[model samples]
Target: MRQEKLKYLAKLALLVLMGIFGSFLISEAGLRLMNISYPVFHGFDPVRGRILEPGMEGWFRYEGNAYVKINSAGFRDVEHPLQKPKGTYRILLLGDSYTEARQVSLENTFGRKVEQQLQSCERLLPHLVEVINFGVPGYGNAEELITLRSRGWAYDPDLVLTMFFSGNDLIDNFPRAELREPAYIPRPYFHLDQGELKLAYNFQEWSPPILKYRLLLWGVHNFRTLELLNQANRVLAARHIGDSQENLSSRAGLADFVYAPPQTPIHREAWDITEGILKLMHQEVLKHGANFFLVTATSPDQIDQEERILLKERLATKKLDYPEQRLRALGEIEGFPVLNLLYDFQQYAEQHPAHLHGFSNTKLGAGHWNEQGHELAAQLISKRICQDPSIL
Candidate 1:
């Protein structure tokens, strides 16, 4: 009777193992068949910081299950040829999330919209307006400059638009543990050493875990099921640590230290770093004979009357035109035309307040440029470029 029971148990165990294997095969196949690759990865660069894992195509479910296919070149946009075609007017756009524009469809992105608007121009129609988006999320001045240096210069653009998001860029320009730890992405930090830019936290390589946990990183990034589990684990960890949903996931913006003044020593330090980077960027653009334009992109809080009041109250300020003045000053100093969009956004918001409904956030009610907002920005940009006597 004992021998018979042992044989039966062995048979049951074998059946269970087979069932598990079969389920794994099915799940793996389903995910692949659906083009739902797991773990859309971000590669840590020693120089600029985290880059979109190149050549990865998958659905990033975070922003309304948004489908993102990171081009082989590692940009968020479609693949662009390196060689400039004759008569092609290329515009290299550099910025952060507002410029990366994951919040909307590619067609709805401001850069593409700018392209569409330029296409409508009779004079510009003879030339192709190819706006290369080098906008990476969580990027600040240093990273943008690095991106332009590494690859943007090769594009042979006629113009370079460095869109500045005043909200969080000040803080993003420098490294702070409070801002970066939660995000868990390695970033290259910079400082003006003897009035020259120097790398501080040079590469993610310094973080031993990035190498030690290499397999874990790959598995988490490449496997969708693992990524989902990782996301769930992160949420749980955030809850356990008593962190807010935004605190854990939010990129640096809004509650900005650089703009919120008592003008602490650190804040002032950030300003210097930012200015130095801009100077370098401008000089580089000039070297290539491309006109550089600085567009100060506004956050919703800066435009919405109600939101503006609340933000100022939090910052304990009356009104913050600090960013605009600073940007315009840099434009004067660096010799790049600064297109301050503060007035444009305000006037548009006042005229069509209903458009705020379109600026609705897909995740956590975090408002960004909706379709209408993109249209406004694009039209403004196109108009400005058209009016510029030299470039068009």
Candidate 2:
């Protein structure tokens, strides 16, 4: 009787396992059939640190619902030939997430908008213009320098545009030791040694196992079910840990340091490193025979009147525009043209009276640029390029 009971239990267990496996397969097939996928687009790169997963496509519905595709070159933009076709004027864009502009659709991104607008320019009427996006989220100038060296120059672009985001690029360039708070993602940093710039791999050296990263990436890439679960987990984690930067307090903390002048020794060092990196980038672009331009991205606090007032009241300073001023000054000194979008963005916001930075799902005027912001940015950038005969 005991043997019979054991056999029955074994049969039941087998049936349960089979049922679960069948259910998983069904769910996976159903998701695939419905063409639904979660955005798991980032992949680890030993050189650049983090890059968009090549040939990855999914529905980005976190901040806004839009389908995103990463070309086989790992750029968020459309595919292009590596060898520049004859009579083609290619522009390579390097920056952090602002250049990536994943919050909106690819067509709505400033890069695409700039490309579309420039197509009608009479200066280069016959030559086809292509703008390749080499932006990655959470990247600082350090990574951008590496990317320009390793990947960007290969395109043989006629112009290289670096979109500098003061919000975190200023803070993210320094070594982890100099930072007051630990960086959420470890990254390579550039440090000056005897007035020479050197790459420090402290972040990579101290990071967790690469195998773990590879496995997670593989799972997300191959399994739609895993992708959904991974996104859900991230959302849950953000909620539980209060990690989203959409809150007023978080923005205030960031603004206090970034919006103001370098108050501490670390802040000063960070600025030095940032400027050094930019200079190096300029030199490299010149060496490659391409014109370089730096554009400072607008911060929400810099545009939002209410947020600006609140920040000024909190920080006890009216000099919230220090970051843009520093970048403009740097461009002037370094002989590169700078299009400071802060003033224009501010003017647009005051006139139009709409949110440029954030969406309805997230706090308005607190995060990445919305569609209107990108549209305005494209207008300004294209106008600058068209007006400047040197770039042509």
Query: By TM-score, how accurate is candidate 1?
Result: 0.83
Evaluate all candidate structures by whole-model CA lDDT and list the values in order.
Answer: 0.74, 0.83
Clashing pairs in 2: none
Best candidate per lDDT, number? 2
Native RMSD of candidate 2 (Å): 3.6
lDDT of 1 by residue, 123-175 (tens): 67789888888988888888898888887888898999999987667767865
lDDT value, residue 383 of candidate 1 = 89
Q: Per-residue lDDT tens digits of candidate 2, residues 1-392?
A: 99999999999999999999898899899989998788688887778767888988877777855688899988898888889999888999998889988889999999999999999888878988899999888889999999888988788999999999988787668665323333334467888898888998644533565556667788988988888899889888777544444342243334257787766666677788889999999988999899999899988888889989988887788868888888889888888898899998988888887889998887888889999999999999999998897666
The weakest ten consecutive residues by lDDT in model 2 span 246-255
In model 1, state the lDDT of residue 39: 61
